[model samples]
Target: MNDTYSNGKDVIRITDVKLTTVQTRRRTGAISSHIVLQLSTDAGITGVGEISDLDCYRMYMPDPAAVKMGIEKVALGQNAFEIAALHERLLAYMPSYFRYANTYPPFTPASQIAAGVEMAFYDIVGKAFGTPVYNLLGGRQRDRFEITYPVFQAKKESDTERYLGYMDALVAEGVTRFRYYVGVNFEQDENFLIAFRDRFGDKVQLKALDFQGHHHWKDVLRIYDRFRQYGFELLESPSWREDYEGMAELRKRVDVDISEHISSLAQAMRMIRAGAVDVFNITIQSGGIYQAKKLFDLAEAAGLKSLISTTQEMSIGTAANAHLGAVVPQLHYAGDPVGPLLYVDDVVTEKLRYDGTQLIVPQGPGLGFEIDEDKLAALQAGLVEWDRPAHGANYVSD
Candidate 1:
């Protein structure tokens, strides 16, 4: 039955689902691969979403052609606005499960397949309600939010110069907040910190992300003490992600705030209850916009601050970050939403514009950007190879 909802809006059933592979240099400085997801409704309304994944999951149907066919099988005839239902349905039928640390969310699709599907639902629902996506998630607290530029550590000299140049360019563009990966060399990390202090002075807000738990819990204090005088902002994933006791103790001892990416809302509750985190950092990768909103609400209830973390998602995924930023009341816009800033190219017709350090959240319906069909075609046609940089040195290597 293709009937209208009781709210007086016409029911828009998802009639088609399509996914495509695009080749581009992602924010992590890899000429990698990403999937663009599109959902078409019976009423002719179309929604867009995108996803990128590392080698974390090996699909039985690795070919995009086959996956697109599978998506249609799972999505066709379903209500486009039933976000949670759609998310659960997609994950309930994945060919592979999320294969990361044991502490992360379980029963999730390994790749960005679930993210793309979830984003599509948000787009359809927002368009259906004639409001921005964040409006559908209990309204927004801010009209705009801030994002940080990520500095990826590289071993090549040219890559080093390029990243430094990228930093300088961002500073010229009025970016005032930055996050640098804390590499293995403490002295080198300290050198980068000193140079950053000398270059940007106190005008810049800096955060140290140990994507790899490089330091033992006892020794972590040693490193923190050395940089404590500089007023280093935050330390993330220092020694172990699931070491809640260590993280809690560090929170009690150090001058720095601690944060790490968690897998599930239940785990977030556990982390909050254990007093393990100063800032609740969750990515859009796990459950897309709907679940991300739930996580923020949980953080708010627990009296903990929350922020959206990105794995350098492309335009659609990054736009999802801004949508989340606008609505999450407890968020400070302190996390990284540097997808457009990191990518050499994007699929959106209108590229995102930054107002100094802040990313201007698009106010239009759905994810606030239109797809560039020609650009999509060009990227799909130019597919040469796909690569993802390792996540961090200590925990999981990509």
Candidate 2:
């Protein structure tokens, strides 16, 4: 028999990993991948964890089998509570040649392992102690979380009407916050901005305007001036990821709050250190929970807010984000942790359901979720090809 404590039980063995892909109607051009981690112990207790593939970005789709193989080799017979140690070892053993890429391929594989294992450990701990993951982190600050739906590729002249209609539908469904793909070329989309401001008025409490790093200083400054009139809350990725100086300058020039979305926590810190942003968009999987917590701490110390957003991951990743957001003190804005909502189908026992605008965090164990193995197997069997070329791959790549 396994030893049990008031803080739950220790993880004895990692049982299995299941990965699945699902399509979504919300965002037209991408597929959602969900990774589920199952953990078992000598005490006959079991836990489940969900993580998403971080390399969903074009030009870097990793083989799920490869990820599974790599993780299985390192994860079996490991203690789930020692998540940090596992993450370190995975990083150390990952091929150095694959380290220089923008998307960490090996890291993605290991992310599943680390997240799954950690979640299972948390489950063991939570189940034994009868506490939620949020309680373990620091207790829940808020029971409900706000969601921001993204309006992608709204560039056409008629797109304003289409988008407004879409927003209206979502608003009717209880979604108040919105993140529009304003892109960098603001002048071209002036009508859309004007329409958005006019339509929602004060009913909309928050707006995360995504500029996709295409705006220049002069244009962004102009757009900020206009957006201020509508009382938008945040401007995400207003400038290029590399332009720290520009970001700092924009922060100085604009009165509105600014946030940045880089690939990792290290980049987030660098931007924060440079005094370039007011909020940090921390994707949980990009830099696992432990490192993400560190980033949140950094943001808090620097008097900056944290926005826990999604990396277009499946429900597992979304759950992890919710738990992390629920615990962290620095999380100020409700994030786009709605990958499940966006998808047509999700592979999980319990889907992360939203009540109107507020997203309720799962209160079970660990990350508080389970995988539907039968559904996952069905999805995996549907995989036609692993290397489908993503759109605009050449353009996004340097």
**What is the C-alpha local distance difference test score of each model?**
0.69, 0.64
Q: Write the per-residue lDDT of candidate 1 for residues 257-287, one digit (tens) a residue.
A: 7877765766676678879887877677766
TM-score of 1: 0.86
Instruction: Give the clashing residue pairs of candidate 2, or none.
Output: 123-366
Candidate 2 per-residue lDDT over residues 1-398, each given as its tens digit: 22354234454555554444433333444444445556565545566665563333444455567766776676666665566676676767653321222232213544444555466566765655556777777788877677787776444676678778867877888888777766524554567767777888878765667776666656778777776665677887777536777889988977778887544555665786788888877765554666567767777888888788665556666777788888887557878877776666666777887898778888776666667777666655322234542221222311
The candidate that wins on lDDT is 1
- Report per-prediction Cα RMSD to one decimal: 3.9, 4.4
Give the Cα error of residue 390 in candidate 2, in Å: 6.4
Q: Clash number for every model?
A: 1, 1
How well does model 1 score by local distance difference test? 0.69
lDDT (Cα) of model 2: 0.64
